[model samples]
Target: MNNISVIMIAHNKKEIIKSQIEQLSSIHNISMDSITIVDNHSSDNLCDFLVSQSRLNYIICDDKIENYSLILNTCISEFVNTQNDILILDPDSFLLPETLKKLSCALNPDNGIYAVCPQNILDISNDIHSFSAALNYVNNNDVSKINLFKIIKPEINTILLSHKLLSEHTLFDSEIISDELCLTDFCINNILNDQFTYMADNVYQYYIGNHNSYYSPTNRNCDLAYIRQKWHMNYINTIPSSNLISMINEPIDKELNVLEIGCDCGATLLAIQALYPNSTLYGIEINPISAEIASHIASVKTANIEESVDLWNDIKFDYILFGDVLEHLRNPSKVIHNCRHILKKKGKIISSIPNLMHFTVLHELINGSFHYTDTGLLDKTHIHFFTYNEIIRMYEENDFNVINTIASNVTPMLSKKDSEFIDALTKLSSHKNDMLFKAFQYITLAEIKDT
Candidate 1:
């Protein structure tokens, strides 16, 4: 077995550190001698506590290096040897019994995976018995049974670094000022290098405290803006729409021509290309930054999709996808009506539209707070809102017949005080499954109405 060095950053949280250390010590594969605590000049006598623990190693950082990158680089240079695999751990993370073992097992150099992270339970309580129960559940159940997420970016809290990866690249980006963003930069670098990060879905890490407390609001905003400027696009724009991808039900063998509206980074188009290798993919993205990235993957053009029907008048598409785009358009009905000119006779328009009549929206309105947010049901960019009936009517009125509808519902937790309002609303609604109160979005497939 290769030497594993456990790296932990401490900042005035002594009790949580103690609990984390105790949990690490319980792991049979890891020894207490391998752990190293880098104290960030804590005034709570955390360094003194580390000094008393003879089995574990520690470093007390002085006022000389205050920046997170410098401190991390200094510790890596001094403590972690070239052959050692490093585990960067958050102090508030409570590891399951087999977390280290699972992480180490998945860190094989043969695979292109450079880093391994355990699944985090952010809402989990700090109970050892609860962790034990979760461990048991993980052990007995198949991996598919657990709700696993396919992540494009690295998650915070607990991550294991491979020695092969560390040798090739620096662990953290010195240019990034924020500690949180530096890791994100590192992840982006890994992705660029064609190396990947794997999440150990079977392994669990119990996280305590607010995840956003590490960086101040000002720093976070500045760093995010910097990252966006550096990367040419925001992280959210780069992510593929999984729900929209699932709504595409086409024959695998048939080579279909597909066009996506607002194909931000061409991620979904690229995914479609993968699904149908022989198919042709086209995209229209308004943002030039994201359009440039997506242009490499598909025949992407930058245009205001709301008024760009002239661009695709000569070409006919088998499928025109609007993934949460109609709501953001000033004239969605006009766009839908214009689709007939560009769509093949048998072609269909598949759109994922947000439900305006969701319980959360109703609840907010009942409390007199129908406020707009960055992204959600009441997004600042959304120009139109539609319920299920309105969505069907919109398509039918636009010379299209609704072929199928799939509801994506999420059961919300309502306050006890608002129960009476919801009860009265449910009693009045005609939908049988409380779909009006629960359906978050509707993925509708519509075809041209036969004259």
Candidate 2:
């Protein structure tokens, strides 16, 4: 891959963004033009600074879509379609002079490997200074005697993604929605278990305590809940994605029309491609970058009702999907009402919405720490929140009869620290299964009612 693109998503990191950009531009392995900054509507001087740096490709989200996974996925959607190799890094992380060269040397592009991870990650937030200075210290005569590339444990600091993962349409899930956790999931679940990983002997130092993070502490903790819910009870691989596959009771053995809303990179559609090879697929996404990528898989229209409704016209559909999308809308009920006009006689509305009454939310409420976040169920962009009953009621009100309802990403499935937290809660409650079933998202399959 001749083209190398570096995507750094940051908001309000005024001090760190510039330094990170400088460190990146200094990389001899990649050109400065390849560096792209994703500014999430930062109030900091990041936007103005980015404007001055004409060589950098910076996408300023005027819409203020704050979902972390959505932001990352948007960048991936833009570049993954090309032959360019992608490097995703934390904005405050400093790369050594030999960092990119070592990583590039370790990667085997022809083997369908998606990423090569860093071997030694020196988290020098306590003493992190200039990249050149850190490199100088590492290269010091006395320090050079020590092995700098001996770490065996994998990390989420920096990941170099190959075109193979993009060709497969794999990206960070907008639903899971945490930067560190998402990278960890992509590395552990998608890459490490397979032969798709290349562990490079390079070091990266993260600079912290320098500027404000885009996310608040509460937001970070809330996102951690999702990571917890995913691995809950060690049920990792089964972490529900679109829930379309689980909720679709009827078969699509015949020629049918299927539509997916908020289909970031058309991931779910890509997964079940073999099942509905004959079916005509359509996608409605809010992010333009993701919409472009989804276009390759299906007929795509950018959404929020106003844009896509005109594009969809009066055409009816067999299935209209909403995978973790309803919450982000200003008026979810109205959107559902409008979607009714395009539903075929037997068409089904399939959706996976985060549960506002999740066990973690309940715990947060009890602890008095619930807050909106850049990601997770309480995503800042989410105007409408739903519980299990609310979702069922929404369908019933929209001329649809719920046929199948399944709980996904349940608290009992998480294998991490929160799983223990869930266990403690479950033990105290008399309603054990009921408490355990307060899933992260509720998946529903509703059939259209006769008018």
Candidate 3:
């Protein structure tokens, strides 16, 4: 049995809320016993209509109340202690009956699973056979039967949280006024805590629609400021992506040791050494000229990462940097493993790679153009390409606990307004998160998992 309680912040849109509640009621064994709807001062009769639903408990927040995180916290706190999982939803995102069933299947307490997300097959709900179709889908759980899903990350649209997180009221940030910004911050915090979140993306389809129509633009800048102040994280821009930067962004105890593979011309080492001037800088580069230049700032060695397992016999670094270097190696996984071996007990590795699913690459593939240029997503130097899912799997396989994942340059650089590809994406339903194809690069930070 699934101990699921549904909670959604419904501001308005009488039609959308009405449909969502009806759909939730029809799910097989799921009932409205612990379900709740927060009517955020709806101008329409939605408040009255929601109250009319005797099955669902409803709350009407006054127009003066603005912080959504506080509202969700209050509602979750009222739940009975027996309810150990809360499914947060957006009225625009409709889930099939099997959505929770699959989530429950993956929510094994032994595995440290704390959250779940469903695979959304783009807005194909109108094409969904029946509620029973979902039932059959989950029962079989065949990989071949599943449609392609965009990697679903944690978003408020449809997510299941452990009751421990909700009842303690730590999942959502009360200080954050922007809902999107708040969820992002929440995800970042959870990741840093070694909390595991699952994406049961292949199990069922979640119809996507206007999940953020209520987002307030006025609060965006403030929320961003809060994130920056709290994390002390500068956005990863033109600099080579490095997890060392995140570790060095704030003050540290003593001078540390840092290493970079493929230290190309040593620009990265110079930049980072400038920030943490006291730390010793080291580099391993294959090109003699680049290695020579890198020696000015870092203790540069002319060597191949794949062949140099003994490159650092006596030294264990506090941090290792791999900025767009792994994808070029014959066995990126093996290179990562060797790097991990040379790290101090708590050392970390930061990496960045061009996203294979970026819209420009997808669009070009759709148009039958499969050519590679000098740089960018299809850089000829790239021997291995990865999507977000593959990147996560790679780190986990190497016995590393991914502390954080940062997606940079998403959507803005690549979207086309009048292209056939844009229409293709529009037809598919996402869980109101950024389209899977929108990201340009994924900059990742991971540390060696403790034995």
Top-lDDT structure, candidate number: 1
Top-TM-score candidate index:
1
C-alpha lDDT score of every prediction, in listed order: 0.75, 0.66, 0.68
Ranking by TM-score: 1, 3, 2
Model 2, span 46-117: residue lDDT tens = 788888886777778756637777877877666443777788876766666566665665566565445776
Give the winner by lDDT: 1 or 2. 1
Per-residue CA lDDT of model 1 for 317-432, tens digit only, reads 98899989999998999999988889889788989999998878998887899899988899988999999999999999998989988887565666775565667788987765
Global Cα lDDT for candidate 1: 0.75
Alpha-carbon lDDT of model 3? 0.68
lDDT of 2: 0.66
The TM-score values for the models, in the order shown, are 0.70, 0.46, 0.51
The residue pairs found clashing in candidate 3 are: 119-201, 122-428, 122-429, 123-428, 123-429
Deviation (Å) of 192 in candidate 2: 26
lDDT tens per residue, model 3, 211-299: 55475666666666776676543211223334446545435436878898888655567557646657788999887655654565578
Alpha carbon deviation, residue 61, candidate 3 (Å):
2.2
